[model samples]
Target: MINQNVTKRPVRIGLQLQPQHMDYATIRRVASKAEELGADILFNWDHFYPLYGEKDGLHFECWTMLAAWAESTSRVEIGALVTCNSYRNPELLADMARTVDHISDGRLILGIGSGWFERDYAEYGYEFGTAGGRLDDLATALPRIESRWGKLNPPPTRKIPVLIGGGGEKKTLRLVAKHADIWHSFADADVLEHKLGVLHGHCETVGRDPAEIEVSVEIGGSTDPKDGDRFRELGASLFTVGVGGPDPDLGPLREWLAWRDATNE
Candidate 1:
């Protein structure tokens, strides 16, 4: 059971349409279906190639597909489950996010991280540097992203919500405390509880309210709402279900949405 004090917000569900082993047409169709089915957010990942299946499997770029999703879906907030920071210049990425925000009429969440995927870096001509270095760059890039958003021609339609994905106690959570509107992590309930304490500590250090940041977690394939009980009890409001491509099934997504609706009510 969720503590009444902690789970204050309405439960929201997200669908990550993995852009792997699928044609553009299929991806587009699924995006449409996800929106029609009442997803609060629609997400894709930032990667040059498939993360699983065949290494040479069919895949698509992240932002361009987000642009398409903006044009296609009227309601769901759209973005990468997280865009990798090293893939593009932070200022340019900020501009791109602003553009998509306009296209979606102010419904874009700028979910980002200090990128991993070595293959994306090596093949795309980016420096596949040390993890610590990448985190340093992300720490540096975020302010520039916000500054760029301020100077844009027309500016973003609204203050775009920043969603930071990662669980590093020292660096990542600190960044989340300083900048993020939402903090996403893959930690299970026990781990999430510990991380939330770390996050709250970071918030205190940074002079930000920890309650201002909505917690997001990956809810695995189980359709039973009981499977999400622990996470819900810990105050994870935004739950994401990932569906893969090339004839993907949305049954699980539907189940999760039902869970979301029931919980919210």
Candidate 2:
């Protein structure tokens, strides 16, 4: 069980405006509305095609939209919900992140994960290697990304926070213990409890404090806001709610934001 005193970080709500099934104008509008509604972070996912709905629906790329978000939003932190590590060279991705960090005045979270979605690999001409191989590649890429951040001319505006998304008990949790500033997953309370215990073991093995990594839980569209209390008890401080668009609804997001405020108070 999580100790309340140990999980003292302020609760934060995030909005992931899935960049599919909608026009760019609609995304920008929703992003603005979410920030106005007080989302602590804004996220978009990285994929070549739609994850759901009409197969050929309108979609946008992740980093480019983030560059636009950097210029447009004044206060919200922006990033891919998790960029696929296999998509670009690690050093180049680091530079891109640093550039965006400066553009956003250091409000960028470098959320990333091992590549999945085989269609993305096949269509983009990247090798569709085994999951273990992909995770190994991600393991190799992270340090290069960190080293590149150090060597960049202006450097990152700050030590850009690394948010790693995955729950693979053996490898992913180990990597999170070694590197991640925030660890994200879509697990329910029971699953999260089990995973967090695994994560703590990894942290102990790595000689790191488990509490240093903030726990982030993804809030599903139909998930009840009260459920966040259970997550909080498991040490999740950041809750991200995802909405897809032709036109997305903001009402549930508003409810989460209110919960954040009340829970924090």
Candidate 3:
């Protein structure tokens, strides 16, 4: 369980506008609505094509869209749900994140993951290696990302928060313990409890304080304010709900916002 004293701060809400089959116009509108509704953060998935249904559906690049989102919204924080490591070089990715961080005036959260999806690798001309190999790549790239951030002509104006998303026990959680400001995972109450236990153990192994790492979960419609309260009890302070395209719905978002406000009050 999360240390209650450590998590006295109110829970935050994040919305992921999974860009699967939506056009640019719809994406813009949904982002605007999320900001208008007081979502703490707005996110887009990093994929070249739709991950579901028809694979070759409408899609857009992650960083480019994030740049646009930075310009479009004034108050909401924006970033990719998890930018694939294989899509760009580590230094370049760091630079891109710094640029967007400035564009949003310090509202960018850099969420990264070990590259997955065989289709993304094959279509984009990247080698699809074993899962362990990909995790190894991510491990190597993280420090380079930090190094390039320092070497950049203009360092990121704000300390961009690093969020690592994945639930692998051996490597992914270890990476989170080492480098992540926030760790996102998809699991139910029992599963989440187990993962948190493992993550705590990893933190101990690395000589890092577990409380320094924020825990997040990606939830669906079945999760609501009550469910969120239960998750909070379990140590999840950042709760994200995923909305898929085309014509994504914001009804649940509004409710979650209300829940956030109510809980915080």
Candidate 4:
């Protein structure tokens, strides 16, 4: 149901190098490999603990890892797959992002979302408010983040791209229209089609061009390669797949990379 005529952005691939049950050395190796293999973006999630596998598993902090990635990688852009908006003060997060952007020489993408992991809040001593409240917090936090960016000692090396993830029709999509340069969702083709319409409606209300925002889709679960053509036809320009483990499996990444490169041609 995607209308390719709406936008014709180039296809790009992303690898969410999950920071769970893996050491920093392992992650660095994977991040290096992902870039070598032509990943356009590399991501790590923001969380205190593992979301899967072992209960009390190995994990690393998000912004710290991203700072390291800035120094380590030379080409690919890096970020948290989606940072929890509720965890840090908005201005502080903006400063952290500015620092990382400088380290990477402007190769940072700020991917964030209204947080949903309750256990993180409980263990980290954060308040796990209702979903609506969290989204409200995000709605308020984003402007503060931007305002802080403007007042920083030296501005961000570039206009750091903000990639917002989620698909809640009312608040989430509205925020996307108001703020995000990139809109990510774990949605299938049909659902993406529907949400894109909702997002466009929000854009109309806000007077922003619907085609200005890049559509990003998570691959591997509901999304298959055959769906890539369908997705591209619908204007999804970025595809991301998550990989994890001490010895990470990258078969899907290679396949997805191939699709991305082929589509770009």
Candidate 5:
């Protein structure tokens, strides 16, 4: 049985501050509101172009914005949903994560993934290899990331939580079992149950305990108290609701905050 006690503390909240059409000022305001309203983490997508609206519309780089977020917000933890391995070398990524970790006083989460989004690869001159190949690259990168962290002149202020986001049954889940402190997926209860079973199998294969990893999901426009309850029942304690731009809406965020508090009570 899944341990309900794992999340007896107040449920944590995360917001993905996706930079689409909104200007930097608006993004800053929403991030400030998220922190003021007691969110546990603040995140942004690692994309170069607008993923939703106009294909070539307003967009910003990920790490620079994270650096800004680290300095801008005093309380909320900050990270990308998953930084693409293809964009930056693993050692450099580790250094960047460590820098942000210090900037936030040990409140940074490093969510990483094998690269997706072919446009990002093609436009940026990264080779869009087969999915399996990218996963292979990710497998190779993980150790280098850890090794670089250890070798850094000043190591991370704290052991920054490493979050791996994906649901691939074979290599991805195995990677999660081996290296992730948090596993983020988009599965519904039944699907999540099945994946969790696969993840458990992967953990056994890796000699790691599946229970040690936190399960998380991306709560989109349809989030509700019942949805949260359903996810909680399936072992997902960290629910992230994303607000994209043009103008980032905080209405759903407010709703989620209320639901989180009420559910804990």
Candidate 6:
């Protein structure tokens, strides 16, 4: 588990450069622009195809783009919004993460979750198991992931923060308590508050400190700054604003970054 207290972290905004309906050139430009505008973390999603807009629209792979971002951008930490764990072997994922970490000079956050998209599973020939079974797979994978990180020839540049994304109380939150350095979830203020209570209870059972795990919210950049204030009061430190591709508008990202700076101050 991460040793730092959550209260010690300043509010930071993230931008998910969603890789759909656009060419790589456009996506690449947005990444650099987000950092220039002061986004603290930059993210992309792991999917074989588009999640929305169109079924067969333009899309790019997650980790490959991340590798490029590692080389291209200088300041913002880069990662997938949450990689599907079922896509690759846990050991291989650890290795890929390490390579990216070294490439980015240790600015990679391994945001991951159990497989979710049916299309990604069907198209990729992965078994779309029951939710319980998939959560179990993630449970089994986390230790192997950590162990593999330890045994790599050239270790991760840093501890390589694990950001687990999901809000399942029994399994996902338990996994987060046991494994994650950051927890990403989608919830309004009340739901988030309730989830944090559940997460803290899980931490207690596992002998982990609740504050060691950072809270992250998924949102659009245009979301209200008032809502952001509510989230901060609930202990959320990271906000990820998702922008879709094919001439994506970055206005919300700029607005949120200003909010981030103001909140941090």
Residue 156 lDDT (model 6): 95
In lDDT terms, how accurate is model 6? Answer: 0.90
Report the Cα lDDT for residue 65, model 4: 95
State which candidate, 1 or 4, has the greater lDDT. 1
Clash numbers, per candidate: 0, 0, 0, 0, 0, 0
Q: Taking the tens digit of each residue's C-alpha lDDT, what string does model 5 give over 230-253?
A: 778777888898888877778878
The TM-score of candidate 4 is 0.97
Off by over 4 Å in 3: none
Candidate 5 regions off by >4 Å?
A: 1-10
Which one is best on lDDT? 2
> Over the stretch 1-265, how does candidate 4's per-residue lDDT look in tens digits?
5655454788888999889888888999999998999989999999998998996899899999999999999999998889999999999999999999999999999999999999999999999989999999999999999999999999998899999999999999999999999999898888888998899999999999878899998984323566787777788988888888778877788888888777767
Candidate 2 clash pair list? none
Each candidate structure's TM-score, on Cα atoms with residue i matched to residue i, is 0.97, 0.98, 0.97, 0.97, 0.96, 0.97
lDDT of 4: 0.90
The superposed Cα distance between candidate 4 and the true structure at residue 55, in angstroms, equals 1.6
Clash pairs for candidate 5: none
Query: Cα miss at 174, model 6 (Å)?
Result: 0.2
Per-model lDDT? 0.91, 0.93, 0.89, 0.90, 0.87, 0.90
Off by over 4 Å in 6: 1-8
Whole-model lDDT, model 2: 0.93
